[model samples]
Target: MVHVVLTGFMATGKTEVGRRLARILACPFMDIDSLVEVAAGRTVAEIFANEGEPCSIPRTAAAWPRPGPSCASRPDRKRFSGGWGTPRAGRSWRTRTAHQIGLRASRRCSPSAHLRMPLPPMRSTLPSSASTTSSSACAGSWRDGDGVQVVEAEARVTAEGAVQEVEVGLGPRSYSIVIGAGLLPGVGTRLASLGLHGRAAVVTSERIGALYREPIVESLRAAGFHPTAVEFPDGEEHKNLAWLAVLYDRLLEAGLERRSLVVAVGGGVVTDLAGFAAATLLRGLPMALVPTTLVGQVDAAIGGKTGMNHVLGKNLIGAFHQPRVVIADVDVLRTLPRREFIAGLSETIKYGIIRDAALFRHLEERLSEVLELRRDLLVGLVAACCRHKATVVGDDEREEGGGRMVLNFGHTMGHALEALTDYRRFLHGEAVAIGMVAAARVSRALGRCGSETVGRLERLLKRAGLPTEIPGGMTPTALALAMQTDKKSVDGRIRFVCVEEIGRTSFVELTAQEIVNHL
Candidate 1:
């Protein structure tokens, strides 16, 4: 068992490089900073700012894991490795270059000179107590207005084509969403890189399992893991407590341990049900999501939101247990029926209206190419949406903060519509398309945004082959009744997310009557 430790200056790509190395070695990876943040419930930046450097020194040292075949990472500026133990069964693969180079810097060297060249020695004794605050070293140059410009060496190309990683900034709970083509084959390696090994439960629906189970199982086996594939009946109806019970039974029968991982591979239904199981099984197990559908990739699979629907309302029973990682492979989306694929565009369009004008325009100008699934453009589109979601999640992991509510742009009525028809009448995204248009009308009625905003949103939905109006025969009274039970309702008022204009949104608390009145 080899314990790999990655220590470097701030922003030197220690975390990213550690992930790559862990993937290659088929071992688990641990970031000390991440663990510390988790333990403290605050970011490293906040810790350093509030308590100063010495305060985090002891905390950092305490976060180090016991020696094992694991990959550990932390910035070298604090030199916490002095307290780290070596792996019991094998040698410690610790990167000593950062500290060793710091030692060789002349006492009188200027900060700029220090930045211009590497220290004379690449390997030397680690310093007992080093200070980046010293005026004589270039370490200070790395800091500009509270930001660190990391060296570009952290970026590396692999044979798997281009991959875009968007990190969700949730302090200690932060995780990465990796977007690219053919990512399924690499899922095992990535999980192993996170220091996860041993038994894993791969959960999916019957249909998706048939299409993707073999590749996922094969990849896990190659990474020296024992994987148990579990499948349940597919559909929104199955995303309920009964199926969740079935998943728990299968997982336990498979003899999964507390350290065992739960990997969700399928569309939203699978991810939601499987994710709920992972969250409750054994009190909680590590989870990784590989969302197969367009809706799952751009929306469902990103945030830590997990749940099964209740008879009363959509996602009424759920937990916010974030996954260790999300692997979205665009190639698998090709298997989706064309209608489902087009419906997925609704969420992409929502991102534009609520947060990004440029993204909205891209959808307008490249609708045809995107529908064709042009590889490069699609990858970029998925990555861009992931970034927007990451930002919102990072700012409000639990949705307790007002900032994250913007993400609920169209879900208010969308959820109600799903429950009204018993999750059979319309797909999630299709319902959201109509909900978005309805919200826009509500916004206009309230004098928050102009008619032009509503028109543009409707046009985009039409171009993408999505419905922009409530279905006929679906009475407003029934819709209002269903919405009153929605999870977003507070004190009998819906905490609705309304569009102020393109790229901005505001929350409006309204009675179910107001919602139906606008529609």
Candidate 2:
């Protein structure tokens, strides 16, 4: 329902004003900080002293909803304000659920001047059809020696049930990323809204499909689409042309047409393979992605790059096929193995360093809650990443312009490590973790960044339980050799992404010998 979120800098009397306005409106008052303190069994001061301010934000955000009608408040506006309530100078919060209704309060400038409290910003107002039975408002007020003034803002909430959408701008090939918890059951309805009907093929790995495919098939059937299940072996090793061929055979057997949709229902591997099949089968079919893993949700499935890995190098064979929609149901992450979950953080950490420095600090400060799968924090983190990726992809959908190459910050070395290990030794994320450390070293060697930058990155990776060092028995020469085949390499020179500082990166071309020398 509508939640009048009172947000501002600290000591702004948000709590005091919220309580008074709640009394005036005869509605309940909810203070996020007090809820956090009660849940933590300690005062806010003690939490900051012991656990630091970074930890407090996630805790407060996580605890905000448990005590009834809640309004999220952030003391550090610079970090939390942009993503949650208001759009910052450079960044836009485009999700349907995160829009802000700006409310302003002004006092008299003179005896003749009248106090004014304007209605919520026009952009934030809801549609006329929205019901007001469940609407709520919040106010933050203060008093001076002259007098006391109060400003209150109310929003009409829609009935979307917390589902938020981020659009990937790709002209005719664009799609929306739908994010929220408990979103799986509505997959059929969402697809129906997109005008997808007829026979649909739900492509997934046997392991993931067994757990999730039924609900998807049921949903599609209810939406007037005939659906079938196609399963393949799970894991990166199974992501090959052979499996892709099997998907084609299954689609043919099911009589799926060009208009038929392919629903990718697993993690990164499934998305890559299914998306490629959708791109190629019958010269292309519409596809939708339901990423089950953290890595898929944050990175792989959001981008339009789809491919199958070759023995020589990872993702050597692929195509650019954007999906019709990407449904990221966060609840699936609860069943993820601990190592897989931790591995996903590597990508999250990469996002922070490559573009958003504040996100990097948030990961460092709130590692525990993030690792614990706190719903609010994870949703925000995923949405932020999707936003960043959407912006980069909008500029260079095919990686033609150098704008999108910055995403390869740790990928050059990471892909080499993956190839060297035969896709068996380390997960993609773990290899990227080691690659990031190596890239940082290269940056330092080239005089781009100081040693402290490398140290901070390493420490953050370590805290995330990711490996930062190259595996034993692997030499710099061998790793450099593997880099020779990477897609980013131009001619014989490898195009490496080097970090200059947190949230800043540049691309550098180096010969194999030069890369080894840095190593």
Candidate 3:
């Protein structure tokens, strides 16, 4: 077994390159900075200021031995599932399985030299610094006197219109979220590569079915699987026990078996309903998602959270049934209604605020490009969101730890607004947009964050064409009541995910009335 470690200078895209390599290698991906943050219970910047950088070394080092999950049964070697999977664990750092890859940016490299850098072969050293002007040439590697090999590589963006993948590293249940243009037509071939065959159920709405059912079914058929398309009415209102029942009947009549694959192809509503169906039908089936909408691709379809909305709350009833794979075809997004597309940006913005300040800044800097549907930037945003979710989910798959709750940075009030409006006043993303504003305000009220932080968030939301204020006419009292029923509420107190800053969050518990006071 071999361990691959990505090390590089700041702004060199170590995290991004590591994510891509992990997806290609099919293994668990982790960052030293993230590990240190998790261990210290603080952000890297905070750690550096208070404890100094050297203090982080021990914390990061202690976490290096184990890659992921428990490996008690396999003492000799820790086997991973993805591209980075084959490394043996040891008692000491020197004897441990690790292949260091150092990333660097060259001043001479040009845009025309941009190309996807392939992974180096195991135990093989590449030229330390090949032709710097040639994008395809090796960036290089070197060995220390201690005999440890560290490969030096230059990270470059792939040419426009290339497929990228983000892996959700959950040990054996690990799966990849494929992002790119015109990917819908290749869904079958990808699924077949995963060793999934036999009966397959394609769950989607009639409207979505009319648009994509053919290509999906044809792809599955070409992959040698028996394909069946199950259609339902579209819209948030139809995501209920009734629709779930209807889905069950259609899948049953279609002769789906326990081992059959359930593929959902639509927006958040369809993903939630179909995922719930897949989770419960026949005691759960392997599922895949072809999320077409911006919201679906970034938030709904990636994580294993699948459920329909209850009359009282959004996602009130759901299970953590992960998908086997997710294919987010950017091309399908072209057909999305303008409002729907804009609404989807809410979740993407949430990701930036909660975990990735850089992503948030990128969105702020390139909002127009995103709005214009710049394929390259859009794909990067989607992939970045997926990476953040995958990291959080990997750490706390069941949300048993409060760690995963940060992902709900804006959902506390968002759900209430959705429930109060009866899912009519706003799209899911739009409501979340307002909820984020509310969360920011609450954070300031509680003194967890400053008005400046709130202002930056509000400004970004407004610039993105999202609602920053809750719609008038809905009493705060009524809104508070709706929030009381939220699943995150504890003993009638709403658990608000408050942003301490742009990319840092903490949970605060407040009663319904207390929440209204802040609002």
- Candidate of highest lDDT: 1
lDDT of each: 0.76, 0.75, 0.76
Give the total clashing residue pairs for model 1. 3
Clashing pairs in 2: none
* Off by more than 4 A, model 2: 1-161
Candidate 3 lDDT, tens digit per residue, 1-519? 455444433334456555655543334566666765677789766765677544545665555545454543433321111111111232233234444444454522311123333322232112421211123323333323422222334333222224568889999999999888878888999999999999999999988999999999999999999999999887898999998998999999999998999999999999899999889988989999999899999989987998878887888899989999999987788899899999999999898888888888988898997898866667778888889999999999998887888878778888888898888888989989998999899889989999998998999989989998888898978987898888888888866788888888888888978877987
Q: Model 2: how far is 224 from its true place, Å?
A: 1.2
Candidate 3 segments exceeding 4 Å error: 1-161
Q: Tell me, by TM-score, which candidate is best.
A: 2
TM-score of each: 0.70, 0.73, 0.71
lDDT of 1 by residue, 80-189 (tens): 21211112211122332222212122223323343553333222212433332121112222334423332222112111234667898877778999988888988889
Candidate 2 has what TM-score? 0.73
Backbone clashes under 3 angstroms, per model: 3, 0, 11
Q: Judged by TM-score relative to the true structure, which candidate is superior, 1 or 3?
A: 3
How many clashing residue pairs, candidate 2?
0
TM-score, model 3 to reference? 0.71
